[model samples]
Target: MRDFLPADKARRERVLAVIRERYRAHGFDEIETPVMEEHGRLHAGIGGDNEKLAYNILKRGLDAEAIRAAAEDPAQLTDLGLRYDLTVPLARFYATHRGVLPTVFRAIQIAPVWRAERPQKGRYRQFVQCDIDIIGDASDRAEAELVVATLDTLDALGLEGGIVRINDRRALDFMLDTFGFPVDERPGVLITIDKLDKIGPEGVVAELAERGAAPEAVEAFRAFLMRPQTLEFHPYGERQIRKALPEGAPDDIVAHLAGIGEAVAAARPSTGSGAT
Candidate 1:
């Protein structure tokens, strides 16, 4: 819905060049992934509720059985969808080409991705993602390297004075469970939380209500997100979380998220990217 004139394109190219040069200097090889991915793979528990924003491709070349299946379930009518991000297709690419890639592959992918989010702010349906993925490296060093590389790239763009925030996936899940979100609705709740900065607490509450979340759970989570003062973290986490967690939780209340602090301390440091 928007057009980039010559000035915009030139500025964009300059930004891209800085990022690409930095990625290469950090020893990341440029790679490409498909713009469209199989719907099944895109929906396979990645991208959280953002998966719901996928633009599904309708099934073509339908045989009689295929038509019947489509009639029974609308989801059966689609086989592929425009990818919401490069991560999923990159995963598919790695699986297909792992034999040729290095034992530890560091890749830089900059490309357009599509997502069907509500039109707001600068978040259009289409945007570019500059990604650095380190595959086959699980020592947590890879994540550290990524943060450093990203910071250097931003510095290359002459950007300064920004804060860095880290999200731990395991810790996020624990917090959601601690807030009493149903197991089935937790993913959507996580997605909503991701948007909290952009949409604010009230907006998140409205969206969760629209998504059919239990009223009490939504209110509890809103309050949780707005909690004040420092939490007294334990092996599992703060004592308050134990009170919120469901009966028969899979892990001990204080036993979860035990290693996160150590991991944060262990990550590679950046001159400017450290939290204040």
Candidate 2:
């Protein structure tokens, strides 16, 4: 097994202390949950090949009798699995603890999550996921708040050159419709386009073509994705620029962001708290 020396452990603990302090000041309550959970609920909300990566567990006693009866049955050996991400488990937790939780429950969970996958530098089969999420509100304000808080956390962590790339799934869908992509194919298209950063424009085009997208549609998608970030918001209306932001933006975007900034400033805990 891998082990960290005393000095390394102290440094890690110090970083965690800074993160906890910053998150708590912003009204995020810390909560803990089990590392292993039922696979069904985890895959229900976020369905993808990502689900297959979860580390399935086979406890000896619970399934031992069934396995013994079958002698060589593969199915009897595995049932429960490790959590893939914090979000799904958080959703299940919310549903279970709805009555006890507040109207807007802001939580910070820092825990190790396991995934069955090939690992390399910076990527691990088992790693820690630090997430702070606010649940129960369907408003865009909640999303904006979450984003801002994430930025705050990053700033606290002393990380650099980090940019919080924000995109609304709805907005992307709207853009897809605008460019004549079918609604049914939009998710696939977005998933491909999302890889634009990792893979170049040509890579995206090739993937789209492989998915049976017509050349013209693929060209159009390439054009749309390549468009410069010139989006502007005027929240109040066309005439009055609401705090010099986009018109269709959620009313609380600016306010929540400002609040996060204020909270960060008040804490003045560290230089690495803000997001890129």
Candidate 3:
């Protein structure tokens, strides 16, 4: 049997205790879901890439060769697989137990998920994900509160330089459409741009070009990425910015980003005690 030394067990238990205490203080109700889930729902709800990363299980009575073949090709797996992430499973849980939950539900889930990937330092095929998601309310305040809670959690964990980058897909879509990018190619563009920090400008431009974006469009995107002030706006400047969005675009996205900026600004203490 695998064994844990006394000191190791004590350290692990202490870590878990700290996590539970922080989550509880933030008013999150703890819940659990099964490790095995319906393969169809998990694959569909979690996302395509995530679906590929799921660990599938074969049932009894299946031939060993068939099971081995299925394992070789995840596409052939049927009906069930190990959980990939807590969010999709949580969504399933909420759908199943909606009637008993409050209109505004704040939940903390601490569970292990399986991923079919090579493991390395700080990366694991099976690891615990601690998450807090507030559902049923579309308020920007809720989103901002989540950001604040994340910052606080990092502080409590003694982590430094933990930057929480926030972006609204809606704002991104507005930018893409305004620049004349085809709707179908927007996801590709965003995915490329999202890697800018890691791969640098030239890498992002090459990826965008490879994905069939026009040279002009790629240049425009590069320009936008270089401009930090795009997100830096006072209330009046923000009002003017919203007015600049393409006609028929959702105003709610602009309002939400503006509210988030406002909330962050308001919460910024001049003393620099907790600016992060």
Candidate 4:
């Protein structure tokens, strides 16, 4: 974390003001959450591997022996923790206030969060995060609205060349089904796929094989990955989305994301001209 001088603080606040105004204009109401949450809730396997980065807050009045014993297991002594991200706390907030909230809640959260990290030039142990979430809406329109709002915010901030990469779990499941991967194994397979950028395609296939993934499924995925890639830029459109994916991608999933792309393009014409 770094201290902000008067000028810097003012400039930061100005930018945040724009973000808040844009988000509110899009119908997302802002809400505040405490910086701390119960330790058990923070580490209940919901935050994934990021849970390891949480800054635990020790319970008051713990003696020396108790502190040492709790070193190996933080949950033993830490009753609360500094939030690593906004998601967990938002979940708790919704659960506690669901009755009073509207049928569908559009939330805007802008706050500082802490994480234990090997800090470097741009990475920090603490930083401000801006998030917008729509709760209780399961329709594809929800997804479209989110994308459109984000792109609109980027436009509002005068930040050029912003793009979003859509990742739909439904589409992923359909692709996995086509490859013949079993239901129980999809999670592990997805974990490996998440590492594709860091490990490369060959490394991903190797790790998948090592994990005992279905051989036929692995071979099919490998072939899909090995297929010749075009160096062409695909503009935002339904056909373009299908062209970027492997064969047998579900029509509904493609249409769902295509709808989002179209909505974003309509909101900001120049900003929607890229491929992922």
Candidate 5:
């Protein structure tokens, strides 16, 4: 982590203030959660690859023999961990306080989160995250509101022309199925694909091969990935989404995202100026 001098710190706080005000204006309530959570909750499979980067806190009062006995299972030694992201803590918070909280909770969390990632430019072990979550809402309206609020916040900060890309796991699953990937292998396949930005297409194909994904499916996906790529900015809509995915894409998912785009544009007239 880097130290912020007086000027830098003041500037950062000013930006955070603007974010908080804009989010609050959108009807989101700010909530605070402990920076640490039970090690088990942090490791529960929902965290995806981030679980590995969690900074676990070792249990106290462990004797030499106890430590030796638990050596094979290191997780047994840690009772708690620094939260790698706010999502897990938010889940626990909602579960514990659901009875007292509103049926539909709109939360704004701006706090520091810790991870054990290797230090690199533009990335750090500790950093602040600004997150807005809509809990208990299953409709596409929640997505629309989130997009509108974020765009509004950016505009408030004098950073216009922000672009938001809408994607869904269902779309990924649909594409994977179209390539004949086995249902059971999709989870592992996703972990590999998450590294695509770091490993490039060839590396992804090689790793999938090493992981024993179906050869035909792997070849099909590799071919799809190797195709000539182009960047064309299209307004968020059903047509743009269809062009991005294969033919026969699920109509429901497409409509869901399209509806979100329409709702966002209706809420913020300026969103039509290439904000998607």
Candidate 6:
């Protein structure tokens, strides 16, 4: 619904330049991938809710009729779809070209990704995402560096007053399982969790119930959200996580945030914390 005029486009380009420069300074290499990718790749179950929101490219030519005959499977009618995010394509790219690339590769990806969703403030079906990823580095410092570099990019753009919150997918999965949330329902549950700022905890619980989450599971998740609301921003403790999220592997998070001192020292202007 938004189109850029000459002035707008110029402004956008300048901001992108700032982002690119910061990323480059961090030793990341820029790369581009096709906007359209195989449908299977886009819906490969690794993208959580992204796979469900994939905008399918309908079948064409005589093959359309053959696919139509088996109407039960809609995937048959779609051959290609726009990528939901750069991360998936980055993984695929690394796999395909690993032989030619260095063992430790830092990456910068900036592109528009498509999603089919209800429009809301600051949320659009199509929008540009500028992402920095550290590939093939198992060390937690790589993760910390990514956050520092991204914050530096924002600082370069003169943007302030934004908090950077970090969450681990493993931790989230553990919480979901602890509450007895169905495996297939985790993705849908996550969509509501991401909206906690826009819609409060009460709203999240209601939406989860509306979406067919078990009553007990909804209650447990709601309690988990309400626990120990602290204005102070300390990386969450392992003891707190173990008692609250019994299924959680607290050691993993302890390791993940081990390099936080580097990122914290690098970007002192921003407030950061690990949240449940």
Order the candidates by lDDT, highest first — what do you get?
A: 5, 4, 6, 1, 3, 2
**Per-residue lDDT of candidate 4, residues 34-85 (tens digit):** 9999999998876765688999987999999998887887679888999999
| Local distance difference test scores for all models | 0.73, 0.67, 0.72, 0.85, 0.88, 0.76
Number of the top candidate by lDDT? 5
Q: Could you list the CA RMSD of all candidates, in the order they appear?
A: 5.4, 5.9, 4.7, 3.1, 1.9, 3.6
lDDT of 1 by residue, 1-276 (tens): 368999999999989998999999989999987788888999998778678899999877878888786786878888999988888989999999999999999998999888887887777988888788899886545665676677677777888844445466665676667667789887777777788887898899889999999788888877765666454322223344445343344554334332332343345344444321
Worst 10 residues of 6 by lDDT: 267-276
The TM-score measured for candidate 6 stands at 0.82
Mark the 10 consecutive residues where model 2 has the least summed lDDT. 233-242
User: lDDT tens digits, residues 1-276, model 3?
Assistant: 124699988987777677777767877789999999887787673354566788877554777788787776655656688998888889899999999999999898898898987655665788778988999877878876776666666656677644556667777777887666787777567767777786898898888899888778777766765654444223323565465454555767766676775675566433122221
Q: All candidates' TM-scores?
A: 0.76, 0.72, 0.75, 0.84, 0.92, 0.82
Candidate 1's TM-score: 0.76
Better of 4 and 5 by TM-score: 5
Summarize candidate 6's per-residue lDDT along 1-276 as a digit string, tens digits: 478899999999999998899899989999998898888888877787677787889767747568768689777778999888988899889999999999898888899999887787877888898877777896767777776777677778888643466677777887788788999888789887877887899999999999998889999888878887434344334444455444446676655554554445555544432232
Better of 2 and 4 by lDDT: 4
- How much is the lDDT of residue 183 in candidate 6? 90
How many clashing residue pairs are found in candidate 6?
A: 0
lDDT of 2 at 27: 83
| lDDT, model 6, position 67 | 74
Best by TM-score: 5
State the lDDT at 163 in candidate 6.
Answer: 49
Clashing pairs in 6: none
lDDT for residue 217 in candidate 2, whole number 0-100: 73
